[model samples]
Target chain A: MSKDYNNFDYLSVSVKSDQLSRILQCYRVLGWTEVKTEDDKRYYDMSYVRLRRPHKIPNKDRLQYLQVRMESAINSLVEIVGRAHVKSTAVISVLVIIFLVCTGLAAWQFLSLNQAYSQVYGWICAVVACASALAACIAGACLRRRERRAAADKISARLKLMQSLIAEAKLLVPQPQNEEEERAGEVNNG
Target chain B: MDKSSRASHSLEDRSRRRRQRFTEDKLVKIRTEHSAGSFKTIFAALIILFQLGIIILLGTLPAFALWWYLLILAAISIITAFSVLSSHRAAQAKAVWVLFVLVFFFGGFIIYFMSNDKYMYARARRRHRAIFARSEKFLPEYAALNAAPDMKLTCSYLSRAGKFAAYNNTKLQYFPSGAQLFDDVIEKLKSARSFVFIEYYAVSDGVLLNRIWDILKQKAEEGVDVRLIYDDVGSRAFSRGMRKKMRDSGVQVKVFNRLISWFTFAMNYRDHRKIIVIDGCIAYTGGSNIADEYVNEKHMHGYWKDTGIRLEGEAVDAMTLFFLRQWEFITKKSFDYSPYFGHYQTLYSPYVVAPYVGGPEYELTICKSVFESVINSARQKLYIMTPYFIPDDSVVQSLINKALAGVDVRIILPSVPDKYYVYLVTRDNAEKLIKYGVKIYYLRDSFVHSKLVLTESCAVVGTVNFDMRSFYQQFENGILTDDKNVVAAVAADFERTFPDCDHPASAAKNGLARAVAIALLRFISPLM
Candidate 1:
């Protein structure tokens, strides 16, 4: 089925909103030109773009494989980022539940018992509940912020790997030195 | 436990394990691959015997006897005979079935009913009618197109029979061989922006299909709607893994009249039409299937000579409709037909292309009627090319009549046949026409798979073979046109092919045994 390339090979891929710019910039290194982009109605943050490149690019199979891996890595990064938010929400919810349980125990001791020891127990329980609430607020703000930073760093590492792949794939795309050579290259690579 | 008892148990376990291994290696694996069909056949036979056993049990009950069972069978046979008499099949076919019913009274009528049940095509017939009814609004009225008298007559007859009409803005390009067709098709497929609808009888995993599939996968990923309809029986060699791979790559695949369906046993009616419609603008249809032999990458029966035509412009709309109508029938799903109608304001051309479809569910054999009309109207020259020449009595008679009237009628057949028995019958049929001055030529060293007919006024091209199955038992599509350039191209191809053809004064006299075999084959050729 494989013959000398006589026409352009087209490709289209969908990227999340956060990764679209980086993905497009990296693909340009592999000789793909963006024809158009359309918003994906199924997902608010997802959009698809159409691209075409000369079918006879040097080492096309290798470049195409790399492009697929790049897309896969981006998808994995997005999933991990999504899971990070879910983890934060769960952590905060558990803390809030602990705070509510402590408050309930403290109120029971204060209302049902009259001895000093009971009152002291209730006060200690109330202080513990306050500390738990404080912990919940700290985790809700600082923990989530730190997790976001960690997710960002993970994405940055993946982007750097993609850039490295792009650097290697760009070498496989023909880079003609002269106008005549460029025209000839188009004929040879298309 | 005693030591002897434990030792005996271990010995038994080892022997049993060895026996299991032997069975797994020999019986299970071999039976699954080689004997699966026989197993199914045996199961079906058992079911039939069980039913008969119950009937016999009933016969043994009080006041029941063999005479009563015989009487019931006779009644059923009579009803089947009457239905055959009233059916819309050809006279010859009907006569054969009627005789069969009378001669083999026990099961012949039952077989006839099973094969030709009135309700077998109900689902397909209903869906086809609905799609065509909806399609009528999308196809513009072309009653004002300038057309020759004969072309106009033929086109109107086709339009009245189905949901196809003539268009003046369509451009036609004919490829004399499958290789050229594939090259053009691949280019057109690469440019598809919206959707690609492909319907073919045979699709094997070969070079040609792989090439087209590569583009199709890419286009599908690009969000283009890509759907394919292939006949399960025709594409028997298309492996399950290949089909799964296509689906995994996002190509929507549908099997037409699946050969192994429990719903109905009406497997005789096949989707034999080969069509490719891209974005509702460009279309290709012809004798070429998606296989290596089609494009000559593999020599099937000597050189595989096939032909196809590419249509660009409004005529493609009809091809798209043909694909969609079949898709809806097989999948039981429908979509809006408006988006697929090509609206190209093509430059003016003198040709009037009328794309039409034919299937078994229709009361009339549309392909046969149109071919007869064109043959009956030929004034000067008539040329026909078909891989198989086992047409029905009417078409053979028409060819004889035209030849007798001094029309230069020539039919080119394949010298190297892919099916030996069918080829013998084809030769016999050709010899029958030779006595009436119709010239029959066998393309030397090549199997001519092109289905085309040309008269002085118009030409017909597509997947309809000049055989009984195509005429009466398969879905077919073709383009009937009075296009001068297209007709000339086909005529030129025929003339070019004549040099490599063998024109015998008469086919070498067959041996007595072979002659008898051919005669027997011809009697049942309608079923072949």
Candidate 2:
């Protein structure tokens, strides 16, 4: 039933069910509390359960504002991810080229190795290959470390935003009223 | 109080404090006003005391003649002291004049008295003849443009030294800026064959100098006689280690008159000339120095505007002599002129380039005479650009009188000046000139440090400014050329520059401020 009603505007209006659910998922993935739905006619109607805007909101309209802010955050994260991917691919290609050059030179030297200079030439080729491989590995490790750091920062930012949204939802929730007192009196009489 | 009012008050207080600090930080004033009575009264009192002493001595001893001689000696000493104190050049010339006076007094008084008038007349006649000779040669160049009759007479008077400044086959190329001149200099240095001689006022260690040093070092290694002479005061920023490095690179270097004693401040006469001679074939002279700032690679005191002339002809011989004279004074070694003379072969060119050197030490003040000649020779149009516009009274009068006679006289100075007080004086002088219908243009982009003067056909571009310092103290070089092409080129550059500048007529100032500026400038113009 929730899935069928989950219609959201990632391009326009931000107060749709799927948008809130995605934010909620981001919060959960980032170890933040999930937002709770409120069920009180005085505070909100059934539409409000779908994360509709309030009629007369006090303070700032932070939910919609947070949606715009989160969109930009996501954009910047995607840009960083794109740049990292490009850099990784560039590094991999350079490493591949260097490895090919080193291996080709090594093979050529090995083939041309004569009776007197065969061992010396073979040693030089081996040393060159080892050095080239070491350099490639170091470059790959550095690129990976940078990519991991960016991912971690993006996740932490998303978690913080989700936590704030859950707090806002708690503020919007209605408290249980005098019906509980009637129930209590009935139990006492019994 | 409101916030703005309180802020303004605080700002005013800060400004007042800054003004006070500025006043306190000023160096002690070198010039002061003295009442005439102070010196006159002192002199009268001293004369009375001296007469009383003479009377007493005559009464005590029988040495009347000796007393009279002593009195005469005292009078001569007083005259010498006054001359030395009043005139800047008098101190140096005093010794020679004193001997003349003494010889006249001691021996053949009658002969001296009789010959003095004749001697003066003969000297005047000789000068007049020299003037006539120079005018006869160069007056035709300005004959058609001679609208002012008095200008011809002034020119004739000023061109007395033109006989010494004559040249044969020559070519002159005027560069509007130091950077352009440096480009030519690098090209010339690259082409130097036997020897490269450079004497500059200032040379600092920087990228431009380093590159020049590199080229010079290479040329030296290739058997070229590379020598350099720089003023000690000018090279004060260069470290000893830097000098050592230059010496290690095989370039012979000499510092001109290194100060050894405090009294040597009188050696304040600097070699302000910028001269470069390559193999006695090509030469450059004018205001540009060998520093990155001059080349505009580094901004020193803001954008640099300068002019230089490259010469290739008999004029190079004059430049060689100019450098050699200074070299002899410093190094006491006379270089053989024969080898250098061989390279001064005449080039068949239409341009008439006359390179001249000037200083107070010379037998004749060539720079002063040339400036006066050019100023007086200007008839239809007189265009001048100088960093410093402090002209002696004669030059100023000539310029003002020419302008009054309806000549299209224009002067260009720097809008953004390097020196504030000097610029103020320059503006003040410009205001006076403008009042006489002279057009004044303040170059807006940067400092216009080029000392350029253009007439209808001929032009003089050089290192010397129209200042007392350049005229009376510093050694300077310039090219006086009658090349129509070069003149037209300079005129075109001036035309392009004139519109972007502010004219004195358009300056925003009150009449009272203008009067005050003029008065202050006139009072201090002599010292400046």
Candidate 3:
């Protein structure tokens, strides 16, 4: 049945769990009013948010494009957040191998070499092994921290871009002057 | 013969015995259910007890003499007769009640009081009315009333009396087979975004329900609002474990008229509607229920032929309302229904679709009226298909009248009946109509579960069968559309079915004893 376009068009968007508030904020500027929010039952890390906008809004294509970009930005932001928790396996592996090699050399000097060389060379190798192990711990922690920082920086940039897109989108779709206008504008605009 | 040949003959005898044993077991089960009896018998027994109490109380009272007691009984009978006369029951039904009252006196009067009391389903009816009233604002007014000029009067009647509006820009798709409808239903459910509302009479445990449950579970997990309502008696095979599984997955479940929970005869009024509304955009309704037999995965009769129709766009709003009305009544909670109604731009279409509902709450039998309207409007042809053919006298008369007026009237019923007693009555009714020049056909080896009525002007496809239960006793929904495409599709289905159906001549068996049995069964068919 055809109705006077006074009705609102609705959309449902799913995003990572903690990101709902920010997504709603951005969507609000894009003329979407948050209707309800639900946590995904299967995916604990995801949540669904339903939003409605005036039907037949001006520049719908541009607004939809911005919405897609905003969603993509949120997706990338979630991936970056996940990436921050990722450990640098390559760095950890290299450090572990170095630590093991030094320990092996120290064992060889202490157990198989002659007494004179064993005392001197064994002490040097033992010190080197301990230092390597300490270095492995320090290097692994530093690598993880650096990766997290880089991920945070990328996320911040993406958030800024998303915010700018929302602003552009907001300008494309005019805000309603009043409640009555908002309700009636959907039909009149088209 | 050799010894091997003798052994083969013995093996054949054993197989034959096993087959006979299986058939005997099935008959025994049916007999057990029949012996348990129907609601009418139980209610009648209760009414007799009430009458006995009144009689004994009057007889034992010291202040009242035997003459006084007799006088009181006479007064009560007179009052009850007046009440029956003033009531809105059909003329024929009222006549039957009057006959019973004169024959059985106080017991019959008490039976009428108990059955006609609005107190039976008062709460449910009140809530349903409220829900429907509240939904009226959310529904946009019918804008294309003149789209189908030929059926304007019927549409107007439904809009005024049934509270259903004619909708345009709503697309209709007809499915000739249950399997195909289900395949499409599964696919459509996969695309659901906001919500899925399901209401059905029966949801037997089978591959069909399992597949639907899988989709519903996944959809619920994805945060879609998935709500299901099934009649407890109809879906008895839907195990508690399955219900818990659905709940655990966040699919909201509600059982209509739980037989054990409700200590009343209201349980007899089952929700016999088959509705599946997906996000207020697409909906499906017809004779098919959520069961294996509907899809022919498992057969109780032989081949099960069920039909369904899919609605896309605005007509779906009415279906959504139908589900919510029942849901609200069962749950006793109101909801903000605005979010579920879709906003769509008006697309131009030639056909007009009006989806309507009927139940005990409405005084008028809406389903019967629609059937009559279609029958009355048919000048050239009228075709009908149903699993059961126990229509009330008015509907039978309408068919017979049309057939006599030179309209080519035909009805197709199931040959392999799920219930033998009901089938006998159906066959007997068919025989009566055949004598009036109405052609009746039985689909051989198959149970046609489709509730369809097609004529030259319009068509009806929904859960409303040509039976008293669907017409008066149960809550039902149907689509009354003048869509040429839909009507043509239904006509085409009937055309294809005719060849497969056996005429009443070969399907009927005449005998005095069987005739007496059928007469007895037909008399109580309305109570059934």
Candidate 4:
């Protein structure tokens, strides 16, 4: 067989001696144990594992394809999560700005009251500052709670997508079969 | 089975259920919280806060040490607080007394209290009696055929004023929004004969305003006397260059009470009046401002609702006089009213329109008086539509009393509030009104900025809100019209808006959430 040929792996696997044994070995290597074979043809007809790629000679191209797909999926997931994080951070920044401005204004007013040196002025300034602070704290707390809830929602959605991907991966691999016939002689020996 | 695998399976299942439940609960909470009725709870809390502030101020001041000074201060404050608390004839008087006390202290208090008694007694004996004596002079004697007592009283008052008040012959048309009104105004400018006078609270330059400005320039070029008066604070966004451009085009513009220097807090009193009189024959008044959003042509706030009335009648003379007085006040030009009122004509019109003007500088709050008169005169039905509904105690009590007296009193407010605390206060007041058998409807589509009042046959439509600002402080105007068709038209619009709203049985229907809003708003109502 010409090793550099594009179709050489398919041709060599078909013509190899003990083709059925080679297919069974490929299934085992791929962690698929629910497939069966009759004569020289391999078949895996199960509801749990539908589509399968036939066994072939191992090569760099096939390995590279799988690796690229995994990388793309990981990259997309990271980008989506990153965008959500950015949005949350931006909202938090706005909240912080408002809080700082309110605090600064209140402090300025309070200090200005010191120039007045009147008890009534001081009390009024203190009341106003307290009110502003209370309002700011309430608003900040509400915003933070909303952000946390949004994060929890994002995480739950991501987890669900991950579970779906795992199920899809399981479907892509071939299964093994005919274990009962192979283990008959071993059971008698035990 | 492995312990870790089994535990992980159970954990995943539990988390999935929890997440689903959490989202569903959150949606329900959001929906309930978003309803318009939630504002009531917030307003109740604000009222409580206002009460607490009054108490604290009263208790903290050194009252015993300065008994006379403190007593006068305390009396004015208490009277003001009581006015805020009660629905009585004393509300306007009390508010005036509060301002009087602030200005002259003890001396002002005595002067005001004594003058107030004399003022009421004199007005009752002199004007009231003279109005009745001269009733047959101006009003058609047949006017009393189906007249209510309040109408009869108003007719008599107008009859006396008609003897001296200049009358003009003109046409009248009512527009439901600022957009349509402005379009008509631009057309009127094209045909302006002498002078064009404009006074408004807010006049922002935008697409619509720019178009109108072009017409105003053309009119000014044609030897038409053009004058514009806008409140300084209200038109804060307008540029100095824009003013110069208008002046360069031969148009004279005056800013009412320009905030030039510090210690001008007294200038806080705004000319909230909206009036446009063209060549002394045509005039316009209502709640519409010169903002693009008012026309639905701009996307500032979605669907702004407003109304304006076009007047060309004896009432137009009254409006012209009102504008000239303000023009004199702002420009210091001693205007001989002869030019404005000497050429008045009486146009026999299908609609009987009377324009009432009120301001803080006036000895009496005419707006509050008109409100009391209108509220007291309701027979079959009363309908109101306002953007803000934070009324002083008297107005609120009038509404409650009217509803309880077997009158069909309905109020329509915006479902989406423009101001948060004002919305809350409105909701709180609505809740109280609902308890007194008044039907409250929220306009679900747009913000209803039109300040209008409709009884069985007549209607009052203008820029005055039901709040203390409109009643006691700001300059406001309204047209009292005896037009059954206009009243019916407005009432029908209210009918179309009512069904889209959601009316809660009470603010307490949501229990704890309502309680929290009510508690919070009570401490902040006065500021609202």
Instruction: For candidate 3, give the docking quality class from DockQ.
Output: incorrect
| Candidate 2 C-alpha lDDT tens digits along B172-211 | 7778777668767887799888999999987877656765
Worst 10 residues of 3 chain B by lDDT: B25-34
Off by over 4 Å in 3: A1-190, B1-71, B117-119, B144-148, B261-263, B343-347, B505-509
Candidate 4 global lDDT: 0.59
Every candidate's DockQ is: 0.01, 0.00, 0.00, 0.01
Q: Is the docking of candidate 4 incorrect, acceptable, medium or high quality?
A: incorrect
Give a tens-digit lDDT track for model 2, residues A1-190.
2221111111111122324455444323222222234332221111112222222223222232333234334434445555655676688678778777767767777788566576677667677777767877887788878877877787678557556755654454332245586345334422
How many steric overlaps are in each model, in order?
Answer: 0, 0, 0, 20
Supply the global lDDT for candidate 2.
0.61
3 or 4, which is superior by TM-score? 3
> TM per model?
0.66, 0.53, 0.65, 0.55
Give the lDDT of residue B336 in candidate 3: 88
lDDT of 1: 0.77
| Model 2 chain B poorest ten-residue lDDT run | B25-34
| Residue pairs with clashing backbones, model 3 | none
Q: In candidate 3, residue B439 scores what lDDT?
A: 93
Give candidate 1 misplaced runs (Cα > 4 Å). A1-190, B1-65, B142-144, B261-263, B343-345
